[model samples]
Target: MNIVETQNLKKFFQSKKGTVKAVNGVSLNVIKGETLGIVGESGCGKTTLGRTILKLIKPTSGNIFFDEKHLFDLKLNPRKAKDILDNDGIDPKLRKSFEKNKYGLSADASVSKKGPNSWRIDDDRSTYLVKGEENSMKVYSVKDITDIDDKEMRKHRKKMNIVFQDPVSALNPQMTVYDHLNRPLVIHNMVSSEDEKLRKMVDILNTMGLKAEHLIRYPHELSGGQKQRVCIARALCLEPDFLVLDEPTSALDVSVQSKILKLLDRAKDKFDVSYMFISHNINLVRAISDRLGVMYLGKLVEIGETSDVFQNPKHPYTKGLFKSVPQPDPDKRVKAPLTGEVPSPVNPPKGCAFSPRCPHSKAVCERENPDLIEAYGRKIACHIFGKENF
Candidate 1:
């Protein structure tokens, strides 16, 4: 079961020069009780993608499904997207059309627009409102939360959370560790009394290998590792079903990084949570992730089982990333395969973003971008690999 899923996710920013595609058409999922690691270069939109999924920054367009429900679809008109609670009152023709498409619109699906106002169609006919389990006619009661009011969204916030890269800046200077951990509990009404809150905070702190006494200290009074532990404790206290760990250990010491990683591994099973671990360290991602995704210029170039991807990278960009890793034995070192600098996101290359740097660039790779095609039990976006497999 997937805890969270994104379909055609995109996030763009407008500057004086042009529109920057921070995250372009990223589609992935985090399975329940599994760690999905995402690795890429510094400006590849790893952090932006993580933040956008948590709704810290709104997405330009896409769909975010959480716990088998449509949590967000920015393109959908919330005012008109109503929850089809039951099959009762639905037009037979519309129901049949939706059934034929398997609860989603197909490319050749000829759905009429003579239904209720809630049932709307876009000009491009790429999206429709009705969706549900495959082959099941029963519709969900909760509607898409694209335009949901802040108060309503607050109810879903506890289910999703993020741990930023910089722990120092993530914590409050004036707030004590106890205050930081207790705020989420109070806001969500997770505890009935102050005593219960205190007990819960102490238990979570202990789980992070911190003493209860440390709670009284402010952020300035703690070490880098301690501060990160506090952040982890705070995120765990909410008991979120999904977490976006954005380079959680990058700012810590080498020794401390291992300890933090171990704690995170333990927390996943203890809390029954799924994670989207975003980092620049390929080795670290390989060590902790069950599945891995490689991003380039805001798009996923390759994704598959961690070990399989590391052993055999299909995409030209993914191969370059692995080759770029430093070798401890100088005698075994090999020259990196990739060349040229990354193209500016404001004006990316016409075809695949990595074509400018790829060694096997061809005329077709420069003319048109290829879709993510499945092969060898993995997904790769490159013309070198035929697209018929998907």
Candidate 2:
């Protein structure tokens, strides 16, 4: 089952220069129980795509469905309530009150304030109302919470949580680690009583390889690795089915990076968590992710099982990314790094965004963009995959 799905999702930022297409026509599905890694260089819209799926950013256009439900079509059912009132033998006066209050309309002879600066009168005789007068008000025609209502979205937030990069910045300076983890559990009603909360907090700290004493210490008192562990513990407190790990180990030392990766892997099994792991480190992605999606300039160039992507890269951009990784063997020769910087998202290339930096750019590559197609059971967006040598 796909827990999350996005179809032709797009996000555009309007600036003085022009419109920046941060995410353009991106569509992907996150299987219910697998870690899907999204790897790309910085500013490739990897973070933007993750946030947009979580509804942190309102998509410019497209649809998102969660667990087979249309997220955009959520609304209070009015007809069902009418049927209940008619058949349930409820008092007619109560029904009138329910209709008036539920829909946010005026029951008596008074003006009803609607939305911003809009007003309507209940009396049949009234043609107009005073401009500045306050009237009975009700919330009607609520916009999508991803667009307007944030508090409503909080109910579903526990299902999807994100662990951002920079552990120090992500954690509070004043609060102790114990307080940090306990707060979310308490706020989300994950625990029953104070004792249970404390016990669970201590257990979580231990699972993250931190002693209970360390929980009393503030984030500043801990090392970079320890701070990251605390951040991981905080994310795990939600017990979320899907986690967005945004560069979780990017800021740590190499040695500490290994430990964090191992901890994440262990946590996945213990908690049965699925992740959308976003990072620039291909080596780390290869180690932890079961599947990989290579992103470039707000578009996915290639995606497949981890081994297939690493062994036989289909797209030029994917090949370039793999070549850029430094090998440890002394006898192995290193290829030159990817040529040219990533193109501007505001004004991407005419056709293939990576054509400027691609080594195998052809006439068709510059003239038309390629759609993401499946070949040999792998998804790739390159025109040269099945074409003859030019």
Candidate 3:
């Protein structure tokens, strides 16, 4: 079963010069209880996609399905844009008319007009209402968590949590480890009494290989490894069904990294959690992921079982990424993988974004974008994969 899925998801940002396509038409899934590792260079929208899925950053347009329920459906509507301009300035009578006629006011769905050109979800709505369109927002037919009130969204947020890459910044310097570990319990009302909270906190700390003494110390007093373990413990405090782990071990020593990875591996099996693991370290990703997705210039170019992808990479970009991984022996030296700078996201090419950097770029690769096609027990997007090209 799929715990998370996306369809044609896109996130764009408007700039003085043009629009930047940070995450364009990305569609993928996270299977239940498996870690999906996303590997890509910096600025490829890997992080943006992660943040967008969690609703930390609203996507410009897309459908996000979580646990078989659509969580968000955002579209643009110009007609209802005026009412949201200045909530106070709109004429009461005129606003009512616009809300009813111009915008096909559905049964109970809301369409908040923003600025003059776009109609976004009512920011006033409890951050999660899903199933919204320009004409008529679908009301009860589809269960969208976004449509639920704030209290309900909080409940869903607890089901899914994110552990950021920077544990130092993610932790509070003023709060002690005990405070850090117990906050989730307090917020979620997980435990009835102080004793239960402390007991639960201590148990979690022990599982993460920390002593009760460490709980009283502040974030600064702990070593890098300890801080990361605390972050992991905090994320699991609620026992989330899905976790977004953003390079959790990149900042630690190799020894510490290995221990943290082991802890995460055990936690996943013990807690039955699904992970969307994002990292640039191919070797680490290879070791930890059940499946891997290769990303480039705001698009997923290839994805498959970790072993299959590493052994038989098909997409040129995927091939380059694998080739870039360092070899341990001096006798097995190789050249740099691929050459060419990543294109500017503000004005990506009309064709495949990797065309300029791809050695196998045919004329079609420069003129027409290719859809993700399945082959070699995986999905790949590249003109070279077409039967005619081969």
Candidate 4:
């Protein structure tokens, strides 16, 4: 089953010069039990796309379905009731009394001296009115899930959680590690009492390779790796089915990065958590992700299984990214790096977004956009991959 799906998702931001296409016509599906890695350089809209899927920012246009349901649709129904008194037809004053009692109307307003006003009478007179009988009405439109009744959304939030980039800034400076982990559990009612909460917190800390003593320490006291672990623990407290790991190790030391990656791998199996691991580290993403998506300037240029993508990258941009990673072996020579910086998202190049930097650029590449086509079990968006060019 597909747990999440976004179709033609687009998000545009108005700027002084022009509209910036932060996420432009992007679509992807995440299966129930697989981690889908979104790898790209910084400012490629990876984080924006993730947030858009979660409805943190409303899409300018497109559809997002979670488990085959339109997450944004909300409907409400409202009604008011009034009583009929006596055979001469309900006295206006008495009708007002009934309306007040049934609908909690203001006590001071005098009932207008009129028979069966359009607002009061139902053509079918069968509905009964009794004092204190419940007459309920919905007072508001059903809002987007995020803006709707927060108490209700909190129930569903347990299924999805995010561990943002920058652990130091993400964690509260004043909050103890224990308080950070326990807050979600208590808010979500994961544990019944303080005792169970403490137990769970300790277990989570242990699983993250932290001792009980670490719980009392504040964010500033912990190292980068330790702080990221706390963030992970906090996400785990919900027992979420999906997690968005936004560059969870980017700020850590090289040694600490490996340890954190290994910890994440172990935790995935232990918790059965599926991740949308967003990162700029190609090797780290290749090591952990089952599939790889190469995004450039808010668009995915290529996406395929990790092995195939690394071995035979179809997109020029993907090839550039792979070639740029330094080879450790002294015997092998380094390849030439990709030329030019990424183009401004506000004014992306016409036709192919990467045409300006693509070495194989042809006249047609600058005039016509390429669709993401499927071949060899992979999807690629490049004119060269088309049959005519081949």
Candidate 5:
């Protein structure tokens, strides 16, 4: 089952230059108990996409469903359902039927609950409803959380958490290690008392190779790796099902990086959490991820099983990324590096975002953006591998 899913999710920013399309219609999924590695050049919307899905920054548009339930689906038209509600009067029998199946509105069918994210109707044309089984039953595979208010969103926060790339900045200077891990537990009421919170923090810290004594030290007192461990510990304290690991080891040394990677691997099994590991380290991604996604200019150009993608990448952009990975041998020459400056997200290229830099670019690549299509047992967004060419 998919723990997290995004459909045509977009996030744009307005600057003096223009609207920056940080994430442009990217759709992907994080499977339950699997690591989905997302790799791309800097500023390709990797971090932005992670934050957007976590609702740290509200997306401009699109749907985000967590654990089959939408973060918010507030596009329901009250007027459209008004007639049905008025005429049928939300018969007690029908209301029970809706509740029994966990479909339709909660409580009174005509009235919505306190939050804006509530599903308020059951109709054919409504965006909130997902009719299934020949439209016989209004089945909502999961709740839509698109426009939920902050208060309601907080309730779901514990289920998902993020660990930033730079641990130094992610942690507060004044806050001690214990404080960092305890805050979420307290806010979510995961623990009953101070001693219980300390015990819980110690247990999580131990898993990260830290001791109870380190909990009293502030961020400044900890080394680079220690700080990251604390950051991971804080995220794990919530016992989240999903974690957006935004380059968790990039800031650490090579030796420390391996240790942290091992820690993350152990944590995955110990805590039963899924990770969306975002990084520029292709080797690390290949080592840890079950699946790989390559992004370019704010969109995924390719995605597939890690080994298959590494052995044979379909998208030109993905191929360039693999060629760029440095070999340990000094004599091994790097293949043709991708040329041409990356296009501005504010005014991206008309057709394919990578067309300007692709070696085998054609007139079609310059005029029409290709959608991700299934080919060669993987998803590729290139005219060369598109259905028409095949």
Candidate 6:
């Protein structure tokens, strides 16, 4: 079963001149215990897409489903739902609801409630948006989060968590590692006593090769690698089913990055968590990700098994990225580097977002955008490759 799925997800920020299309329209899923890596150049919405999936960035439109439940819907938080209904402005209310959802909204997953990152339905039949066969699709309207109440959103957040790109900023200088990691335990009611929390905390840290002594230290006291380990430890404290790891190892030394990567390897089984891993480091992503999605100018132009994407990229942009990955051997093919400035997100062109920079862009690529279509057991969003109208 898919742990998280977003359909036609879009998030745009308004500015004085116009809107900034940070995340245009993205559709993807993180299947159970799988790593879905998103790669793109800086400001191609990799971070924005991760944040939107975590609902930290309120989506302009689209449906986000968590473990098959319509996230932030009225059933999840009736009070927040009523509030949105009262306001009558769909966008702002859903956005506002998400802001409070992590604190204490209606998060409703019950395990026995037990085990690491695994949940057991207390009843034979859990609630569903539509009354039909198990795991069947419901009407899309029910998936909208606009009607959810703010107070109830938190109930849903414990199952999903994020470890951000910059561990220094993500951690609080004032708080000790214990303070940082303890909050999620408190929020999720994972432990009844402080000692239990401490035991679990120490165990988690130990798994990351950290000792109990480090728990008392502040974020500023730790090295870059240790800080990231602490960040990962904090995310694991919740035993989240889905984790959005946004460039978790980018800020460390090469050796340190390897250690952190090893920690992540151990974590997948220890936590049994699915991941939406976002990174700009293509090589690292290729090594770690089960599936890879290539993004260009705020759209996912290619997606498939990591090996397939690296070996047989269909889109021109995807090819450019593969070529750019540092090859250890001699540089034989000396084509000029893929060159062109990324277009302004505030005023993107009318056609394919990657057209301006594409080497094989045709008149159609400059006129109408292409839909993502299936090709070679993967998906490609290029007019030239899609099996559709030219």
Top candidate on lDDT is 5
Error of 5 at 279 (Å): 0.8
Model 1 regions more than 4 Å off: 69-143, 329-331, 386-390
Between prediction 1 and prediction 5, the one with superior lDDT is 5
Question: When superposed on Cα atoms, how far off is each prediction in RMSD?
Answer: 7.4, 12.5, 9.4, 14.4, 6.7, 10.4
Which runs in model 4 stand beyond 4 Å of their true positions? Answer: 68-152, 386-389
**Candidate 2: tens digits of C-alpha lDDT, residues 1-390:** 456656567888998889999988786767777889999998899999888878888888855545432112112244432333234243344335435544323334343432233332333322221112133212222112234357867877787888888998999899999889988898899999889888887887888888989978998899999999999889888888778899999999999999988888888888877889999988889988888988988888888899988998878888888888887677765667788999889999988998999888889899999877667677888888733342
TM-score of each: 0.83, 0.78, 0.79, 0.77, 0.84, 0.80
Global CA lDDT of candidate 5, please? 0.81
Which stretches of model 5 miss by more than 4 angstroms?
69-140
> What TM-score would you give candidate 1 relative to the actual structure?
0.83
Q: Tell me the lDDT of model 6 at 119.
A: 18
Q: Of models 1 and 3, which has the larger TM-score?
A: 1
lDDT of 5 by residue, 1-390 (tens): 578877778999999999999999887878889999999988899999999999999999977877754323222244433333345345455455455655554543442321122233434323333222221323345444567899989989999999999999999998998789878998999998888888899999999999999989999999999999999999999999999999999999999999999999999999999999999999999999999999988899998899999998878889888888897789987878777777889999989999888888899999999987777777788987655356
Candidate 5: residue 159 lDDT (0-100): 95
Candidate 2 off by > 4 Å: 68-148, 386-390
**Deviation (Å) of 320 in candidate 4:** 1.7
Candidate 4 clashing pairs, residues 3+ apart or interchain = none
**Each candidate: what lDDT?**
0.79, 0.75, 0.77, 0.73, 0.81, 0.76
Model 1 scores what on Cα lDDT? 0.79
> Compared with the true structure, what per-residue lDDT tens digits does model 4 show for residues 1-390?
456666568899999999999889886767666778999887799999888777767788865545432111111111222332223354455444445544333333222211221121222322121211133321111112323344665666787889888998889999999889878887778989889888888888888889989989999999999999999989987888778898899899989989888888888888887888899888889888988888999988888888999998888899998888776687765568889999999999999999999999998899998877776678888988643247
Best candidate according to TM-score: 5
lDDT of 1 at 128: 41
Give the TM-score ranking, best first.
Answer: 5, 1, 6, 3, 2, 4
